[model samples]
Target chain A: MKRKQVLVRIFSLLVMLSMLAACTPAAAPTAAPAAEQPAAAEPFEIAVVVKITGIPWFNVVETGVDRAAKELGVNAYQTGPAQADPAQQVKIVEDLIAKGVDAIAVVPNDAKALEPAFQKAKEKGIIVITHESPDQVGTDYDFELIDNVKFGQHAWDQLVKHMGDTGEYAIFVGGLTVPLHNFWADTGIEYAKTKYPNLKLVTERIPCGEDQELARQKTLELIKAYPDLKGIVGFGSLGPIGAAQALKEKGLTDKIAVVGTVIPSQAAPYLKEGSMKEGLLWNPADAGYGMVWLAKYLLEGNKITDGMEIPGMGKATLDGTLVKLDLIMDINAENAESLGF
Target chain B: MKTLLRRHEAYVLLIIIVVSIIITAVNPSFFSLENLFDLLKSMSLMGVFAIGMLFVLISGGIDLSFTAIATVSGYAVALALLRYGDSLNIFVIFLLAGAIGILLGAFNAAIIYFFRIPSIITTIATSNVFYGILTVLSEGKWLYGFPTWFGDFANIRLFTLYSPAGNPYGLSIVTVIWLALVLLAWFILRYTVLGRSIYAMGGSPSSAERAGFNLLRLNLFVYAFIGLMAGFGSVIQALLVQTVAPNSLVGKEMDVIAAVVLGGASLAGGTGSIMGTVLGVALITLLGNGLTLMHVPSQWYDVVIGLVILVSVGVSAYRMRKNIQRRVITETA
Candidate 1:
């Protein structure tokens, strides 16, 4: 009976410990006043949530958050799910709500999956600003670093310039259901058909699942299947890096032109060696900085309007609570070093 | 011959060869020496983890924390590299990682052994704790800009072969380490007393204790050894990717678990071999590579893998039952 009691005590203790561990927020709450108070007196406590943590792309985003926090005099910190899972992201937001954060900024893994959490944050009167996910419901504003259509067209233009407006090209997205990636692919393909009539898509946009290894494997298979494939466009951050590696290994660096969205630091070697001709991405740090800037803007009782210049991101146009900024940087050999992830 | 054919390892090897032939038929490039080396190199990281997991499985325990342990240990090495930069030796980095792994592994072993908690439940809970602590500490950051020597480690080739299409393929240093580890594990399992004790414990703990084996010490050693391997695997993974992304390796536990199971390791414990685990890793690597080459949609990949595992396990279980029935009948006669 004594042993049983001891075991039960230990079991409950274990359960308590685990609960405490799970509920521990990624970023400790800073002592700042609530969002309801007009803030000239205390720093605004804003939480920036990302899709996943510990990758170069999001690392850069955190740097921006730090810079914005220092410059804007806001208590801003970035946190996200350890992996790209929306449910985990929701739990983080719920914890933030309980902690009474002034505002929340996010780069959601799934826009719809995060809807309920965003709704709850808004209901709690926390200002919510999201980046990279425009279709997200229940956010104060959704921002895009580049217009999705124009971004696709930019990729198409690069492909045409390299392939000389002819021959076979392939498209790789993170996944079919990843709205942003598929948007780029669909727009690029449609633009290519009307503009570069001779250019052919080798396959329906193949999903690489945002994995570098999968992207490399798919690129290798595409090369074998289409032998004369002239170019490749990767829509996800890892897609271009993987495609470039595969082409380089196959000794087809000169034969195929690889263009995609990738971190400049990760793509520097390939960009220098000419395996990857170009990379397209808005500075993630800029987006991170902008998200916090906007959150603070709304908190201070400022209304967003078209043609209003915002710090870090210049001249944003408001379209039904979505802020669109055309700030995509084209990364090439000469500019790759300067771009910095 | 019949006995050899009936062996689980034989079945796994057959699946590997059959898959290879089919892939080669569809895409002749898959048959090249370069592709073969690429497949092996790709399997090397998972192969290391599988070997570690094989020990856990054979000892009548499950460890869901291997990937978490790997990430934590690997992150330590990455931070150490960044801190010391050119002043740090690669050997010291690996040593530090291994030490961290052992400590974490010992923690898991102690709790499970003392509290008598089912290993799977304890590990699942511990994995979350370890990962949670890591995330909080690192805040989901990545470590990049390693020394050039470390960056080049993954690509260090001993011998090179050119495919007909002129792609250069080579046996990487990482692959050499993986192969060496496999040999070492096979040696330990086949010849060491601790290895014998592990088998005994898996078969029946009471019997193992009656035979005068120290259960407490053996449990500690087995879990610690797995931790050491997780650390080693993490370093290999970091080198392969050339960047340490904290969250990148967490969900890969499924792949490692699947490889061990497919290699003929029974989850119920007491049955597994290093050769079987290696074959299993090779088969999985080949399946992914072959399917990609065949242009099978990425979405279908998971479904296909699930079916393959189910079918293989089903067949193996059937054979095991039939052999048991035969033994019972023969004994009565």
Candidate 2:
């Protein structure tokens, strides 16, 4: 009986140890910096909030945030709600404000919903930085990975190459209300209308890029509804992969070409299989790294100038509280494996 | 056939049929054979997992941890497959997932049974713990690229059908598994002694104990089964999407809960049917899939889902009243 009790106790001890080990990664980066900060002034507590956590896009962003934190010797960390919900984000920001972080960087799930939270953060004298959310209120500055309009036009250019600049094509965004995605859709459609007059948008913009299953279902429905759909430009990271999978399932890989922003590894198989023609993206890690660096730069009371070469990001152009950088990545079958997630 | 009309699930089915007709009128291709088969594949995940939730709801409790269980089990299996998957059969993978699910479900059950706290609050707390631990361990990374054979299960089909345009489609293996689970749950609830005891316990825990029912065993059974369902669901989701994303499944709990309640399951317990749960899931899936096919604006999606959940809760409340009134009539007679 004593031995059985001992065994059970040992089992629980092991479980507790593993949980501690699991938490160490998230806590270690912040904890170690604090312990060593006696000789130096207090490090900045910068938190870069993304739209959602645990997806490939933001996971990559977290890595970049870590890299910048280590390089700059700042108490920088990244967090967001598990899923993209504005209310959860507001709650997270409220907690951060309550804790009195030095700066709060956000990639909004819903920009307008976050206005009140950002305003609260600003009132608390917290430095506010944002990425992928342009024209958002209550931010000191918004940094963009690429020109949204140009990014859209680039996707259309790739689609035009594969699809011969003509036929009934469709557009898809991360969500109908996702600001950057809609901007891309609008600019891409406009560019296509002027350049490729024969090309047609067969349907209204679909909001399927955020969830793979929804994207797959919508793509299947699209096929059944419009069998002649020759090209598709998807705006979200998961969109093209979903479209590619659907086309592959129906043995229409050669018939329909898909292009969008996708994690390379996820798109590699689809790219090799010929279902997805191209995936255009900027390294999200770079965006995360750049957001942190920019926040530090502003907090140090530095005035920004146009055409400044920012580390982790390239040469930048200023657009009145928005930092625009050019670092677009064109991922194809051959190089998809090399462009790490 | 005549008595079937009295079933609450029958009305949900009728609603689905009516909705289908309306959608088909606007988009002629909405009624196509290919779309139906695609939907059969699409709705399989929610339909299968909601059955697990159905038992809990019927037992006068709720379990919100199923999605977290699914995510963890799915991630675990994905990691396992990455290490040594070529030798493992698909069924063995399912077993691994279910075992993991059962352990977690037992965790939720143990808390609720020992503390006697409301199952909703307990499950909700446990779900956060489960998902938080998962995020830390996974470091929020999505694992892909199992052995080539791993992809084969998703392609397995009972039969292939060609649409009018000569495009081939099939009812997926995921749908087949869901149907099999449906039958198993129906048989248990319809014919087994354990099933009746569950109903009794849900009606009144004290009354059930006095009548010699084992509350511990029943609690263990229902919670473990929900976890088991989550385990199978994780594998099914990976098969369909061909990727395992940790955060994708957890926030989708409301749709399943809404569907089961809509299908005629009373939250107050003492009643629920596998048939009703299935019809409820169908109604939810039809709205999502049909709206997409008909090209309704995407922002309207959430509003419709919210309305379904609201209407279902209303139905459950009204049914409780009707149930009480019938009991009074019986007592007087």
Candidate 3:
């Protein structure tokens, strides 16, 4: 056993060294066939680094991105961890730099962890764009595709519309550590404080850790904790469904209106059953499509000016190189039945 | 037949039946066919790892680095496809992953044999180093989009034995592969000369050395075997779910160890069986799934798991004590 341990240590060290060797210098294609394309065209590579891969949510988005890429004839690839881990996202960015991908589109797992990697990518002349979770935007990532600030405002707007202006409300969110969810909560609270001063947010926040079961448990606990709560705002896919189930089980379904950003399909039963009022979501597929379009548009020396619309993607206004797609929300009950899961 | 019923395995079976009966009375869904099958399927993966780890324990050795090795294989396969683009075939990815596993196992064996380091200490260090390397290489991103072959193979059915929910969903090719590996491992342990030598060494390394057992070579092979299993475990895990989250089973080594201990495997060398580990895995999975259905909070599941381990280990210890006392009285008389 001792012998085995020593052997592992030495071999792991060697692997580490080899990994470092493969990390940098080879990040970029030494010579992307610049001549193969028209003389005016510049060849480039774009890397879409997701939080993880092999799931329908992110994969469908990647599929849309590939559609945009194929239509535009630009080179792009999607990569991410198999599970959601921020620390791993940081390393992926670094590896992307070593691979010399021309631009990087990241759905940041962590805001801070990828800051250094994003800066490094920028230093290497890589365009860094973010989608959905823009936690690392304007720091590690050059720009965010989604207007998170607007997203937060949109969530509050929907909640207000669902519950009417004056009511006691509570928030069911993903992990507290998830920057986008945290920001959405913060903005939602701020909107409540400034705009609807009469609306009281129930004591404490519900963090479900992104698990449906835990979210349901938290919602049950919250119902017990605050029976007077008239509205619930969920900031994740499972949170709304979990909260709705909790509300229904407690016979408070009609008493409390549930609203938030969730996948329409996942929230359909809750909506149709009248357990929840509605849920909002940006089209992840379109978001991915726009990201690929933006990467290709910029790589072609297409000029980074504001209000330039790339083909296949609707008119996108660029603030420098960051393209922000207008928010598209999916309302449950009214609009969720037809939505794909 | 009566003696077989009196065996530790039968005792465990009785305990499961009795305990689960009580649990089901509280939450009837806990006994549902869907739930039971899911529990078995989910627990089987952990069982496979625990069974492999059982060999190490009976030999008075440990492999903390198994988790790290698994993570590396998972990440490497995913990264290879993305980095190499279409240059490498998907089949090559599995081969590369397996080769890497074997190499890692060999390295573990060689180091422990040559350095005379304690198995626990050495493996812990290697685990950290191995995980660190994987962390740096992956940069915190998961690798996805393996060819459909991965998930498709996992969905294949074999008779009425498979279901498609968690582990219960289908006769997952990965599950079958792991079972085969476990059976082969069991055979090697019970029937082979080298296998018996390992047990002898575990019983008393000094005595085994005096008796001309090649401790270094045996230790090396044993560690390598463990490493190989860890690698295979990761592959199955990746294929089982078709994704390798860098932190997929973070801190899962404890669960595997718990299963082994629960299965009546002694921490002290030379006293465990592959069959015992399987039972242990089933028990742990059933408890977890049953509790979840009972509306027990997900956060509390780990705590329940810990308690189950303690209770099961206590029972095994009590039975072992009685056996030892009986032997002593018989010898004295």
On DockQ, the candidate that comes out on top is: 1
List chain B TM-scores, each candidate. 0.96, 0.94, 0.87
DockQ for model 1 equals: 0.34
Q: In model 2 chain B, which range of ten residues has the least summed lDDT?
A: B1-10
lDDT tens readout by residue for model 3, A218-244: 564444334466788888666786677
Name the 10 consecutive residues with the lowest summed lDDT in model 1 chain B.
B1-10
TM-score of each: 0.87, 0.90, 0.56
lDDT of candidate 1 over A1-341, digit per residue (tens): 22243346446545754653464333222222223545567778899988767667787888888899889988888877655667777888888898989999988877888888888887899999988776778899997888888999999998887777989998888776666887788888889889999999876787873677667767777776667799998887878877887787667899899998888877888899988998888888888899989999999999999989986568888899899999988898888878756
Q: What is candidate 3's CA lDDT for residue B182?
A: 81
**Candidates 1 onward: DockQ, in order:** 0.34, 0.23, 0.06
Docking class of 3: incorrect
The lowest-lDDT stretch of 10 consecutive residues in candidate 2 chain A is A24-33
List iRMS for all predictions. Answer: 7.5, 10.5, 11.3
Descending-lDDT candidate ranking: 2, 1, 3
Between candidates 1 and 3, name the one with more favorable TM-score.
1
Ranked by DockQ, top first: 1, 2, 3
**How well does candidate 3 score on lDDT at residue A41?**
60
Q: Which has the greatest TM-score?
A: 2
TM-score of chain B of 3: 0.87
The candidate 1 chain A region of ten consecutive residues with least summed lDDT is: A25-34
Over 4 Å off in model 3, which ranges? A1-341, B1-7, B26-33, B81-94, B159-169, B321-333
| Model 2 regions more than 4 Å off | A1-36, A120-125, B1-5, B308-333
Q: Give all candidate RMSDs, comma-separated.
A: 5.2, 7.3, 11.3
Compose the digit string of candidate 2's lDDT tens values, residues B84-188: 879888988999999999999998998999999778767777877888788877877888877778888788878998877667788888899999999999988
